[model samples]
Target: MHRKALLTLLKEHHPVTADEKAMTQATIEFVEANPACFERTLLIGHITASALIVSPDRQQVVLIHHRKLDRWLQPGGHADGDPDSRAVAFREAEEETGLTSLKLVSPAILDVDIHPIPARGDVPEHLHYDIRFLFEADPTEPFKLNEEVKDVQWVALNTITTRTNSVSVLRMVQKIN
Candidate 1:
């Protein structure tokens, strides 16, 4: 049922760029081909969910310094066996950022990305079909960082480049603008 919901979301997603279009197609194909796409045990790759959390006024975005990756990124994580990407995104964001007043910007998917995660410990390198959602939260709300992240900050949208040079992050900023 969750897979079907994702399919419907992809169908209505209307990607914002050619790269996103390609990623959307790849995600559809991957999800369709793998029944256990939500399971991290699928060493080849697996589905992940993320939240592009923005300030209530939309001028700033919440970024987390991922402990393991040693880089700044949006709040997100593995779906485990849960297929509801929307819920996963919200849950991961709340857990990672400790923002209690998060509001879903929309029910629609904000973006889709397929990126490779490097091998770590016993885990092999694999692709992450990341489903992203837009969310709004009060930037003034103090965030309690969890073990998954080192720090959390509200970055001005114009100065996002200082945090990370991820192409996907820039693309999302463009979409927001």
Candidate 2:
């Protein structure tokens, strides 16, 4: 049931924004069309999972200064061979930020994004059909930095609004608010 939660969200919720509507439809279509989409070996495009981790009080979000992208973004990565998107999100969050106490806000997807990733090493440019899930992490917990990101910090919600400008990121924020 890789798509059960996501299909439920798209079918039940009337998205407020055009971006949300489009992304939801796209995700449904993509999943319905390709059963092997969970594999990163699918060069055409693959499912990338991301975790939008917010503080328990909902005032701040944890973002990583992605070493590759050179920008502040949520903690996430490719699904590899995993068919479970939620598991992918949690694993990536822990691996990227070392937050063992992180908890998922919900099993349902918070957002879906389709973005192009530039070629890295021998990998060709491809689309990342990112399925994002909301999560909560302790603001007081000491974060252990990893090689995946240059820096990690808790950012105020307003700062995310002003800086990230990503539709999916903002939508995740809206989900909590």
Best by lDDT: 1
Worst 10 residues of 1 by lDDT: 168-177
- TM-score between candidate 1 and the true structure: 0.97
Off by over 4 Å in 1: none
| TM-score versus the correct structure, for each prediction | 0.97, 0.88
**Candidate 1: global Cα-lDDT?**
0.92
Give the alpha carbon lDDT tens digit for every residue of 2-97 in model 2: 656545654664566787788668877886787778887778788889999999899999988899988788999998878777899999999999
Cα displacement (Å) at residue 168, model 1: 0.7
- What is residue 174's positional error in candidate 2, in angstroms? 2.5
lDDT of 1 by residue, 53-84 (tens): 98877899999999999999999999999989
lDDT of each: 0.92, 0.82
Against the hidden true structure, what lDDT does model 2 obtain?
0.82
Tell me, what's the RMSD of every candidate? 0.9, 2.1
List the pairs of residues colliding in candidate 2. Answer: none
